[model samples]
Target: MPDLFLLNISASSIFDAASPEAASIRQLTFEFIIAASAVLLLVVILTSYITVKYRSKHRHEDPKQITGNRALEIWMVSVPLALVILFLFRSLATMNAILPDRGNHTPDIIITGHQWFWEASYPGTTVTTANEIHLPTGKRILMLLNAADVIHDWWVPALGPKMDMIPGMNNYLWLTINQPGIYDGACSEFCGQQHAWMRIRVIAQLQPDYERWLSEQTTNTHIPQDTMAKAGAILFLESTCSSCHRLKGTAAAGITGPDLTHFGSRQTMLTGMMANDSGNVARWLSDPQAVKPGAHMPRFIFAKDSIRALTAYLEQLK
Candidate 1:
C-alpha cells in the first residue's frame, strides 16, 4: 500500500538493518568499510610523502635510483596477508551465524517464486496468498524458497539476507522482524521483462494481528451480496479466468496463476504494479497487456458491464 512518495521511508534498505541477519550483514559491512578506509589513508599518506620527496628539482642532478626496499616489500606482503586472514575469519563467522546446520531443517513458511510474482503458503495450514506476505515480530521464521519457472531472488534489505530461488532446487532464508511496519522489496534477480515490476510487500505485525490475518487468509472466498457481484462471480468462474486462478469454495481451481481466494483483501494488482481500486481493477480486466507490457496475464477483452461487475465482485472479496 506504499505510494511512490512513501517509498523512501518504508522501502527495505540495507543501511537500516531491522532483523538479526541484516544486522550481522551491516556489522560486517561497517568493519569492511573501516578497514578499507584505513588502508586508503595509509596509501594516500605514503604516496604523498613519496611524491613530495622524489619530485624532479630544477637542478640537473638526478635522484638516487634503487631497487625496491626489502622492508617495503615485506610490509606489503605481510599487510595484505594479515588483512586477508582477518577478512576470511570475519566472513566465515558471519556465514556460520547466518547459516547454521541444525540437521533436517524445517520451515515455517514456503514461498514459491514465479515468472512475475510470488506465492506464499503456510505449512500445515490451508493458507495461501500472493505478492503480499505477512510476518510476525520477534520470531525467527524459517522460509523454504523455490522457483516455479526461472531463477528469482527474494530480497528484503531491511528484513534479512537475500537468497536465490532456483528451479528444481530449494533455498532457505531466515526472517526475524524487529518492528511492526511495512517493508517493500523487489525481485533482485532479473527473470523476464517485467522483473522490475515484480514487487514484494511484507507486513510485519504483532502476534495477535498476524494470527488474525492468517485466520482470515485461511477462510474461503467471499460470497457476493449484490446482483452485479453475483454476475461477476459467475463470469469469473465461467470464463478463462477460472482456468488460471483459483478461488476456494468454488469450481475455479487452477495452479498456473495466483490464487484469488481473497483478491479483494490485497492492496495492489499485477504484483504491486497499481492500486487496487474499482477503476484500476476494471482497467486491468479490460486489457492486462495495456497496463503491464510483457505480463503473463492475457487480456480478456471484457465488455464495460462485465468489467464493472467483475470489479465489484472482486472489491467485496475481503
Candidate 2:
C-alpha cells in the first residue's frame, strides 16, 4: 500500500523538496522564518521591559509626559525598513532563478484541468493520460496549463510554485526534478464541490524508464481475447460507458471524460481518491456519486455479473 499520509499534507510542510526549484523556495521560506522570529522576540522583550518599568505607582499622580525621542523613532523606522529591503531583493533573486526560461531545451507538456480531474498530453505525440504524469528526471519540463471549465490551480509543493489554469488563456510553469520518486499534488483552487478530490500524481523516472513508459502509453490498449473480457468489451461499447470515456485504438472515442487507454496501469482512480483495484473499480462503477459527490459520472446500475466481467477486462488493460 502507498503511504497515504505523505501523499496528503499541508503545503507549509514542504520539507521533502525533491527538485531544485522546490529547494530554492524552501531555502527562502526558512530565511523569512528566522528573520520574522527575531523581530517578534525583540518586540516582546521590549514590550515587557517598558510595561514593568513605567507601571503606575499612585492613582492620583500622573507620570511625566514627554515628546517622542528622535533616536528611538529613527531606530524603530529604520530597522523594519532595512529588513523589508533585504527581503525584497532576496525574493526577487529567488524568483529570477526559478522562473521559466524559453532558451533552454525543455520538453513541453499540455495540462488541461476539468471540474475535478487533470488531463496531461505530450506535445507532438499521441500520448495522453489522466491524473498521473510520468516525467524524466534531470531535465527541465515546461507545462502549458489551461482550464476546460472553471479556473484551477496546478500546484505540486515538491516541484515548484502554483500556476492558475484559466479558461480561454494559457499559463506556463517549469520544473526540473533531480530525484526519481512519486510526488503528489492537488488543485489549489476551489473549483467546485469535489475540488478537494482533484488530486494528481507525478512519477519522476530515469531517462530510459521514462522513454519506456512513454512508448507504452502511445501504443494502443491491449485487446483481451479471453471469454469474459471479450464479452465485457462488447458490453462496454453497447452501453453508455463509451459516451464519456475513450480507449485508444477502439471504437470508444469520446473525450468528455478521462482517457481510459491505460486505466488498469494507473495506481489510483477517481483523481487519486482511491486505489485502482478490482474492488474499488467495481464500487465506483456501481455508484460514482457515493464515492465522490458532484462527480460528473452518473451512478451506473450494472448487474453483478456485468460488474465482475468489466472489472476483469479493465484489470487486463495493463
Candidate 3:
C-alpha cells in the first residue's frame, strides 16, 4: 500500500511516515483511531437499540427503577479502565521506540531557530545556511535544536517527530529519511507576527548528492563577470546590505541575516515565503516590509536600475 503520509496527492493525505520514527508515530495513530472508532460505533449502536427497545409507545408507565446491577456497574467501570490501560501501554511502547538513541553514531547538525528563520550548521565545519535543510537518506541524523530568540518548533510531519526549539536549552531528535524528497514544514509554535511565515524545507537526497551539495555550500560565493553585476556587488558592500547578510569569499561577513553564499541555488527565498526569482528578489529589495510584514529587512528606496543590478548579482550567486 502507498504510504499515506508521504503522498502529495491531497492535503488530507499529505502527512506520511517517511522515516522510521514517523512510521512508529503513524502506527500509534492508526491504533488509537481504530480503538476510538470501535468505541464510538459500539456506543452508537447501543444507544439506538436502547432507544427503540424502551420507547414511550412500548411502555406507557415508568419503567421500574432498579438500583444498578452489580455486573452492569462492574462492567461499566472495568471495561473503560481496561481500555485505558491497554492504550497507555501501547503509547508507552510507541514512545520508547521513537525516543532518540544516544548510542547511535549519527551525523550531528545544529539547528538554531531564529525569530522568523531557521539556520542549520554541520558540526565541525564552517558550513551554515538558512531556511532549507539537506539530509542524506537512509542514515540516521542527530539534530540538536535550539532557539536564538523565543520558542519555535521544528516539525516535518513526513520525516519525524516535532521538537521544540527552546531558548537557552538544546533539545535533540533523531531522524532517518527512507526516501529522497523535499518535505515541507513550518513553525508550529506561535512566536511573533510572522510566525506563520516561518517555514522550512528539508531535502532528503542520496548520499552522494547530499555530499556534493554540502561541498558546494561550503565553497565561496560566485563572482559576477558582468559589469552590472559587478557594480551591484560593489553597491551591496558599500550600502547597508553587507551589514546583515553574509556572502562567503567576500568581505561581507555579517551574521544578522541569512547567508547568501549560494543564494541563486536556493529554490525559494525569505524562508520559503516566495520563489527565488529576479522579480521577487527585486520586489523584496524595494520594500521588504511590504512583501513580508515585520521582517527585519528594511525597505531600500533604491532606483529601479540599482534594484535590477542587485537582483542580477544575487541571481548569479549559484
Candidate 4:
C-alpha cells in the first residue's frame, strides 16, 4: 500500500467512528503515532546522555575517546529492522480485515466514477443516485467500485480502506456502520481538472431510515405541479440536456452523466461540492464551464425566464 492512500481524510470533524472498520483504522493510526514517538524519545534521550557523558571535565583535557560497542551496533541495526517488519505486517493485516474482498461475498451496491461525479446504483433495486450515498447501519454493506472515465479512488477516512476505482477494472470496499451519522470523503486520485471538487457525502442511517430513503429513491419523480416548474420539466426533456442525464420513468434516458431522478432529494449538487439550491442550479445550467472549468457539461444559452423555470422544476424532483 502506498503512503498516499493512508492519509486520505476529509470530514466536518472526527466522528465517533460509525463502524468497527473505521475504528480499526483509528487504532492503526494511533499505533503508528505511538511507535514513531517512542523511537523519537529514545533517540533524543540517548543523544543527550552521550553528549553529557562524553563532555570534557577538565578545561585542557580531552573527553574519553569512546569506540562503538558491538552490542549497541547489533541492537540498533536489528531493532529498527524488526520494528519496520512488524509494522509492515500489522498494516497489511489491518487492511485485509477492513477492505472488501472475495470473502465479503458480493456487492450490494455498484458505484461508478465519472469524470467528476459519483453514480451509485443498488443492485437489487431501481435506486440510483449521484454524489450523496446512503447505507444502513449495523450491516456489512459491500460495494463494487469501478470507473467510467479516468482512474479514481474512493476514500472515506472514517470508513477504512481507500480503494481505487479504475477504468475497465473493479475494486471493492465494505462498511458495517455502527451508528447513524453523516460522513464525508472525496476522490483521492486526481482524475481531472475538477478532481479537487469531486466530493463524496455518505449518510449512514438506521435500518428503518435507510429503508424509507431507499423506498423514496425507487419511486419515480412526480410531475411538477407549479406552472413554471411544469414548463421547465418539459423544456428539460426536449432540450439536449436530456441526452446526457438520466431521469427514471421519463423520456430522458441518457447515460453519459449523473442520474437526476432524485435530484431534489439530494442536498448538494455538482457532484456534492455545492449546495443544491435554485441559484446554484440556475448558475450551473447557464454556464457549467464557468463554475467547473473542466466539466463535460457545456454552456447553455437559456433565457433568464427559462433558467428560472428550469431551476424551479429541478427543485421539485423530490
Distance from true position, residue 194, model 2, in Å? Answer: 0.8
By TM-score, the better pick of 1 and 3 is 1
* Candidate 3 Cα misplacement greater than 4 A, ranges: 1-15, 58-60, 101-107
Clash pairs of candidate 2?
none
The residue-by-residue lDDT of candidate 2 on 1-318, one tens digit each, is 544634533233366787888899999999999999999999999899999987777767776788789999999899999999999999999998888465654447999999889999999889999998888999888888999999999988888788899999988887898878888888999999999999878888899999999999999988988988888888787898898889899988888899988888998888878878899888888888888989999887899889888888888888
Question: What C-alpha lDDT does candidate 2 achieve relative to the native structure?
Answer: 0.86
Model 4 agreement with the true structure over 154-268: per-residue lDDT tens digits: 9776776678999999887877977677777889999989998888888888999999999999998778998999999999999987999988999998899999988998878
- What ranges in model 1 sit over 4 Å off? 1-11, 57-61
Score candidate 1 by lDDT. Answer: 0.88
Task: Give lDDT per model, in order.
Answer: 0.88, 0.86, 0.85, 0.85
Which residue ranges in model 4 land beyond 4 Å of their true spot? 1-16, 49-67
TM-score of 4: 0.89
User: Model 3, residue 171: what's the lDDT?
Assistant: 84
Score candidate 1 by TM-score against the native: 0.94
Q: Go through the candidates in order and give the C-alpha RMSD of each one to the true structure.
A: 1.9, 2.5, 4.0, 5.2
Per-residue C-alpha lDDT of model 1 across residues 217-255, encoded as one tens digit per residue? 988999999999999999999999889999998999987
Best by TM-score: 1
Worst 10 residues of 4 by lDDT: 1-10
Candidate 3: clashing pairs of residues? 5-15, 5-16, 6-16
- As for lDDT, the candidate ahead, 1 or 3, is 1
